[model samples]
Target: MSVQHPKESWLIGDQGYPLESWLLTPVGAPNTSKEQKYNRLHGSARNCIERAFGVLKSRFRCLLKHRVLHYSHETSALVVSTCVILHNIMTKAGIMLNEVEDEVAEDFDSPNNAVDSSQYIREGERTRSRYISTL
Candidate 1:
């Protein structure tokens, strides 16, 4: 599948990934009202992504908890792709996912994964600042 997005369009990312023209990251610390507002809005948007991942992992246990598939990188990719395709098919077919217990689901939101140390891009900083000003 091919996807096309405008240059100005963005994907919300956590602080693990650096800010980019097409990827927005949260402000490190909000010292002003505008920065605080921006951080709030940015966080709200980012949570949607986090929640989506949580749901995906909840539906497909193998993707996160089980770690049952041990294969070459290419094979692993194929496995993930297949799972995603199956997920979509199941969703479209109205197959309801079994409700996960709160205790089990709580682990999905744990911040145990290491965050990548990506460098900040100058243009991305400017874009973020401009957007915050508008807010």
Candidate 2:
């Protein structure tokens, strides 16, 4: 598998292992200028997502603090999904998202106003973060 992928390729992030990243090649290698440009562009886009997650995780204290009410799993799913949708709507409307901290705000990229990958990931994992749910 390594031989087929070659060390020269960059590993795109799958759903698992948020901290683990692999670059196929060393930081710099001889690639076509267009390829290099595209790689940089992709990296920048990915970084924007990272920034968004960083913001969402920090702002949504409830998500970090796990609390499970006695609702059925399916209903719980709906509730969580609704919260996420509302969060996105609030963010888009530029309403204050519960000020977390200046450091976290700084962590976010300039609001190119892009959404994050967490929104698209499997709903279960989307609710889990480095912070544990308090509930």
Candidate 3:
């Protein structure tokens, strides 16, 4: 039998993470102008994504706790999609969530990041560098 691996993709991560080809982290202590620019741009993109998640969680308290949810992956996906649709409807109806009290944000990334194939690492690096150059 043969297995099919995922195609190469680029993902941005923050500090304290190992540099993988698929995951690109901001250059720590960026010395060169290009590196500094990359960091600035990457930070801006990550900030927008974080803010979107915060807003989603604020509106849908059900999504606040990840470990508490025990649904299958498909069910979880449906729940999130429903929440997003409902949020849009509420927004259009001029409804807004009263900010929840000091609620801690949940981690949203998948927990299955153990793919360490050398081929993937090399491809991920090429993808990240190419993507960054265009940014």
Descending-lDDT candidate ranking: 1, 3, 2
Top lDDT model: 1
Report clash pairs, candidate 2: 7-24, 65-133, 65-134, 66-133, 66-134, 66-135, 67-135
TM-score, cand. 3:
0.66
> For each candidate, what TM-score against the reference?
0.64, 0.37, 0.66
**Compared with the true structure, what per-residue lDDT tens digits does model 2 show for residues 21-117?**
2321111221455434543554565666566655666666554436444578778678667767877898899876544332212222222223336
Predicted model with the maximum TM-score: 3
* Clashing residue pairs for model 3: 21-124
* Count of clashing pairs, candidate 1: 0
Candidate 3: global Cα-lDDT? 0.66
What is the alpha-carbon lDDT of model 2 when measured against the actual structure? 0.43
Error of 3 at 88 (Å): 0.4
Lowest lDDT sum, 10 consecutive residues, model 3, at 103-112
Worst 10 residues of 1 by lDDT: 103-112
- Model 2 scores worst on lDDT over the 10 consecutive residues at 19-28
Please, what is the whole-model Cα lDDT of each candidate in the order they appear?
0.68, 0.43, 0.66
